[model samples]
Target: MGTLKNQVQLIGHVGQEPQVTVLENGKKVAKISLATNENYRDSKGEKQTNTDWHQLVAWGKIASLIEEYVFTGKEIAVQGKLTSRSYEDKEGVKRYVTEVIVSEILFLGGNGK
Candidate 1:
């Protein structure tokens, strides 16, 4: 078998305020949007920035940390595994989502700005 992994690491600014929810089992889950981007000059020498948004999910203690510390424009580094799943929406339409299931997080230069 080939040596393979499903890990991901990223450093970016929080795209929005995390939405924290509590399950019936009293477990906490937080969903956060992260913005990662790069700036470069195009072929015409025009400076431009391209940003990609990522979906991040944190659980338990990490979820609490996100609720208390993470905010829009906050910068943070995260290590996690990429996950994808599908579910049916209220309209009975299937929806697919990709997300980083965050395991560890570190505050970057801008905790919040």
Candidate 2:
């Protein structure tokens, strides 16, 4: 039960190419956008599809794996934890963001590059 704290698992399509960056300390970090879709019927019984976008971040070995194989439209499964942070934007306004810090990944149904 303790290990379940803050855990998150998602299986979805990658929305864009991973943005990879290397810090001066030589650590690699990658960021990606994932889209999860749900289909349901509306109150009127009309079919509807809803899509939600998520922000994902990976570090070190996980980041390297993402850089090598994850790409736009790729389907993948990821397990991680949720984290949130705030920063001041260029406009000097406070910005808050939530992201999943990926710990594990599994490629699904695609010939990975």
Candidate 3:
């Protein structure tokens, strides 16, 4: 039960090349957008597709893997937990952001290029 707490799993296409940054301590972090699509039939029997974008973040070795292999349109699966943080922007306005902190990643669809 404890393991299931705050767990999130998503499989999607990478929206763009991962942005990897090295911290002042030489630790690496990576960020990317993933797009997931859902297809369904409308009331009129017409097919419709909805796409949702999610922000994903990775640290350490996971970030390194993303820096090397993850790219635009590549399909992958990630398991992580949702995290929210607030920060003040340059304009002095408080901003809140929600992101999935990736712990596990699986390359899918073969030859993830």
Can you tell me which runs of candidate 3 are displaced by over 4 Å?
A: none
Q: lDDT per residue, candidate 2, 26-107, as tens digits?
A: 9999999999999999999999999999999999999999999989999999999999999999999999999999999999
Per-residue lDDT tens digits for candidate 1, residues 6-92, read: 989999999989999999999999999999999999999999999999999999999999999889889999999999999999999
Cand. 1 Cα-lDDT: 0.93
Q: TM-scores across all candidates?
A: 0.90, 0.95, 0.94
Q: Per-residue lDDT for 113 in model 2?
A: 61
Whole-model lDDT values for every prediction: 0.93, 0.95, 0.96
What candidate 1 gets wrong by more than 4 Å, as runs, is 1-4, 110-113
The Cα error of candidate 3 at residue 96, in Å, is: 1.1
* Model 2 misplacement above 4 A: none
- Sorted by TM-score (best first), the order is 2, 3, 1
What is the Cα-based lDDT of residue 39 in candidate 3? 98
CA shift of 2, model 3, Å? 3.9
Q: Model 3 reaches what TM-score against the true structure?
A: 0.94
